[model samples]
Target: MNLAKNRNEIDPKFKWDIEKIYADTETWNKEFQEIKTLAPKLKEYEGKLNNAETLYEFLQLEEKVSRKLYLLLIYAFLKSDEDTTQNQYQALKSKIQAFAAEFGSYVSFMNPELLSLPEGTMEKFLEEKEELKLYKFMIEDLLRNKPHVLSQKEEALLASAEDIFGAPQNIYNIFSNADLKFPQITNEEGEKVDFTESSYFKYIISKNRDVRKEAFEALFGTYESFKNTIATSLTASTKKFAFMAKTKKFNSSIEYALSPLNIPVSVYDNLIETINNNLNLLHRYVDVKKKLLGVDELHMYDLYVPVIDVPDMHIEFQEGVDMVKEGIKPLGEEYLNIFQEGIDNRWIDVYENKGKRNGAYSWGSYDTMPYVLLNYNFKYNDVSTLAHEMGHSLHSYYSRKEQPFVYSNYTLFCAEVASTVNECLLINDRISKETDKKKKLYYINEQLEQIRGTVFRQTMFAEFERETHKLIDAGTPLTSEELNDIYYNLNKKYYGDKMVIDDLIKVEWARIPHFYRDFYVYQYSTGYSAAMSFTSAILRDGEEAVERYKGFLKSGGSDYSINILKKAGVDMTTTKPVQDTMDRFKELLDMLEAEL
Candidate 1:
């Protein structure tokens, strides 16, 4: 658990090869200027998209310029996240962000202009030039969103306001990652350690109750002190969603957020409804947690502590990678090859460092290898995170290989499916192979926690987002008090009477980064449910299911996320998948409780 205090102190091999995107910042700067020069050319084709030849040429040039722009943008983003405290990389990130906004404004006319073409004009263009066929799905999707497409002038105005719209999220990232500080806390070994956002997970899961309590209070206590400031940023972000949704003629911010992926509002509704019906299962889980911990009262800090301890189980990073590769063997050799390639090529940045961004994510452009960032702490959960993010990376790899740039990026709704599938497989593999009763119980507990954290916890978040957005849509200001009350109540309902919902946990919403991304967290719940279905199928049906699952990953954004998953045999449009997940949860709970 030795952490690097500076980025330079970390082993180079453990870092992602960002040089694959750009050899140096000077090269990034050169391409940045090139894109700036080429972006203005997009304006030349405005009001002329009705002609088939002109439309095809415009799309080609636009794609070429955009590919370069994203490459530069991704480079800057990776550089900035490496150390948020570095002003040079921060400036580099800012430059690309501003240019990207300008680029968005430049291409703003294309959608509106395409929509304004004569009825049957796009069909005629597609029939005339074979090249335009490549953009058929792109054009059709645009037509589907015709009601939401604003005028060229209006679209340009919104596009120009991209940076302004992004300010709240940007402010939150800087404030949390760079400016905010957590007080030092003593570990289980009586060593005073720097408590950080990344290390908070480590401390909260400490075997020592006092250590866990101290870290929990220290973390939330700091957030509580700045609750008003974080509340302002969150409120502003919600208002931004409301404004855009209203401007775009949507019924609500959730509709606006889901529309891009063509997700039905029912999908979001169904998740909340289904999970609400299953609250008893979560309450039972809380009861089990209380009993297993042998506590008179279970608090928020006690939730993450492992009730079944396997003290000797420490997974080094490479061992975790090996376990992941072994766990995913059901996917066959090709998937394993690609996973190993990512490892050999240094596509992952492993370990925490000073000023590093908290949590883990997989990101890359179509032209580059999918890269992952992690704050690896040698815990079993960190191992699962490695498997989860590599799941995303491999999905991106397959999608980019199989589809064109336009369709390479999958929707967020489908994004978590691949990641969660890997996690489910890895945990199940661990559980199946372990002979020791205590270790097996530990894995079972991990699986149960996964369900609780993913399906139950995230659905709670989705509900919170729904409640807050409704307030904004109704012209109600989201003050800190209102937000805190809403979150605290949801915790009580979800966790039930078995556990104590601490007042400090009320300020917890202020610390969630996903709150800034409107209507996004719900997918984690749906995705996990879908993954449970997929994992069950793959393990039960064997290669037939694996092929279908891989096909879904390769399909990417070419179809609606729901349809893609439907083709893969799990239909997210209904509540069956969610119900199936709950059934599995109950089975796991039954097993864990019997063992206890």
Candidate 2:
């Protein structure tokens, strides 16, 4: 295989043409200077929100500054992800951070001023000014936090703590993706292959136990070595959260987390309970793995071997595009057309290369067409991955086409729904079209793997996060030992019965970067459950469901996220969607058992 390369010759597919962001560096520099000059003028509105004209003027200038700042940051990330070692890209990253900090210095008064208004004055302001009505939600989001909104001096003090709070994510990224190393393993054919960070999952899923053992030991052993340092950084991150929540008068860290998105604690509880009850089915799947592999006992590392051999699932690039198109057809013609437009244009960079960003994502700006970056290997999983990323691209296209500037960007909480819906539909299509018994079984198990990884495993991570934060909120110190104990115990609860709950698994919490991000992992579980319900609804109702889902894609951040999801038909406030998804897991287990 000629494969791909990004070192000497950049694969056209792996490299995004960021020239679209701004024709070149010269244009970006010009815009950067213009935005910097505009920043100082924002101070003109420091004490003047009572005057609509002044407020509107400040907002317009602020918008321009923000748009330019966005362009700079996107370019820096694109360039950095392409190759993190580039000094040019690294310099821009720091420069942008400094500019953001400086910009914060100027506009720090905006939120404070809004909260200072008389209780009902903002409602009247929205009614009076046509321009202000467009920003009504933005204004009220501040007022909603008036109780927690701090004074200017205190807010400034907290704002200066950004880097301290960001330390965990930074440290984890450096160690995991860019720094960690794994030992070489001898495969069944006696060929020695060294493991890279990108190869961790691939190696773990190998049919050979020796390969799995070597990879698991090497990968996690590295983490265990650095456990102390990683634990300290994570503990400090928890302190940052504890401090913020306490100062803001929230009862607990979980309350502070759910309050932002208007989600309830019960939603989290329901997810954990639903998964806990379904573990017998999951354990049954693990038992099947043990029998198939003929292992006396199953370990965590042996979980990924393919039980059913899938034949000729090797799709060419064009065939992958066609499959994604057919799978997403139910999303209606308009949504599909916009998605097709992105594919037809050079909006996607679709192959792997050395030093290219790991994993995949759909990204673009309000000013640009939605674009996807993928590291394609043409495996069956790649086909599903294509559908997943395109789900996000199409969502971005529709959202940008419909929503105004302020509302154009949606929250991370709703981000996975569009992507996962596409994945589910693609899997359903593959299972329907592929007729060979073994191949179909392989596809079914692949779908099962999605539930195992995304729904069940992530919920476990969510539980761990919630538990750790609760400890922190209670004024408990989160030492490395304490974190290890909490993490190892949860590992036992989730995977203990079937697979050995190795003591080494305790270090896993130290390495998980998501713990630094308050209340993020649960979204994967909630989003997967919601997508399953949406997928079933679309299949049964067809056009009407497609139209509503399309409406959801276009909604962007125009409405509250909870309200937006409800309009699209799945509500997170209740547990119906999650229960339905868990039932599907049971059904899938039955099908697999029949095959056995």
Candidate 3:
């Protein structure tokens, strides 16, 4: 049961060797010092935007320095997240953040000055610096801020003050990751199960009603103790956002937040409208789940129970890789080949271990390959997670290959699409291919959970964020009780009478860190639905869908998030993608009922 001590070692087969990025910590430190010294050289270009060649060299130097800085910063953060309590690791991580704040301050004027360049300065800069070729989109990204980039002094003021503004997220992170502890719950064997945030999901989703209830209650009840602190942190986070919006001259915080993605508020509105229309289908699926579980009462805890209690459905690590490859082959050979490189080249760190980062994400820098971190427990869920993370990695890989470093960073909107596309494809493919009925049911439930968590539940969070922000905007203070009421009510709307709506679920919003990002959670809803629509198109239309989806991946930030989605075939501005996703959920629920 003690994975950290017993099965703690990450299998060489699953571990990625980051040594290739820097070789060793000593080497990294040496490089870090070198990078620190390189900062002052950037000051050489402080006021040098009069000509194309000067701007070009300055931009190239800046980009090169930034690439090195990014690699260094990520390595430190990744290493620290793997174990935050380590003093040395914390020091390294803190140094990186502090350095980054300074680095950002140093380069803050690059944008304001670049925009200040004579009318044709941009065209000439691009023509002059052949090396700036990679940075065309990068420069244009700055140009996009032409409407917003304040003067050099104002921009520097904002940049230097970033650390001061990050107090909310920093406090939340410190409290959640380090300060809080959950009550121990006795397992079926009558042994006390010591719960960590890493293992909270396992307990709260246990098949035993008592385990789920106790875990859910104890975990959240612990959060209740710190609700005041959390609320204060949230207020700071909100005010930080509001201050930035005011300073940027945007009419509202939402507009300022979304302007970078080039997406209009209508897209966000369209998603909520679409989800609102289709929520009945989601409720219907919840109804089916309730009946299938045959529980007299369906609580929030019941939602995560194993629809099938069978545990051996856990596949081996190698088999999980095979499953992901097979699941994604629908995208074509070249696509699969690139993914295989990720698999073989240790682009992934699979399996849970002592001090490993909890959960999973796809991470890497534009200068490096996209790497995935997984705490795999071999459940069918892990298999799906593997596919999901690879989706992000390959998306990064492809965009890096197709676009320059400047255009390399894809918008969060597209980022989720790549991941969800693989997730949906894997779930659908696994369900379609399986012959064992109980296992088939497990497979089906797994897919349903995807919709439940991603498409439906996230929209619920999106709604929560919308209203919560409005609460702030309207000059109404959101106490824990008020926040909970809004969130709990949304849960009721989405799940209806089918599930036991618990009081504890109201505090869920406080626990979710994504709320700090402001208007970001809606992307999960939009992304899931968009993935479903695009996946359906690819499954039915084959080559055309694949090409469009691939083109969408390579688009990076070249287009608005909504426009990229629309061009890729799922028009988020319309309700069709949302409706299509809901219809698919209904079909799956109908099939699961027939099979059961």
| TM-score, per-candidate, Cα-based | 0.85, 0.89, 0.87
lDDT, each prediction: 0.91, 0.80, 0.80
Q: For model 3, where is the 10-residue window of minimal lDDT? A: 1-10
Q: How well is each residue in 1-596 modelled by candidate 1, as lDDT tens digits?
A: 47566898888989999998999989888888888889999988888877999988888998899899889888999989988998988998999888888887777678778898878888888999998898898889989998898887888799789999999999999999999999999999999988898899998988899999999999999999999999999999999999999999999988899998899999999999999999999999999989988999999999999888764767899999999988999999999999999999999999888999999999998999999999998888899999999999999999999999889999878888999999989998998898788888999988998899989999999999999999999999988999999999999999999999999999999889999988989988999999999998999999999999999989979988899999999998899889989988998999888777
Tell me the RMSD of model 2 versus the true structure. 3.4
Model 3, residue 258: what's the lDDT?
Answer: 79
Candidate 1 off by > 4 Å:
1-39, 72-102, 156-203, 206-240, 314-318, 344-360, 373-379, 474-485
| Top candidate, metric TM-score | 2
Distance from true location, Cα of 370 in model 2, Å: 0.7
Supply the global lDDT for candidate 2: 0.80
lDDT of 3 by residue, 198-236 (tens): 787888767778887888888888888888789888877
Clashes per model (N, Cα, C within 3 A)? 0, 0, 1
User: Best to worst by TM-score, what's the order?
Assistant: 2, 3, 1
Clashing residue pairs in candidate 1 (N, C-alpha, C atoms within 3 angstroms) = none
Whichever of 1 and 3 has more TM-score, that candidate is 3
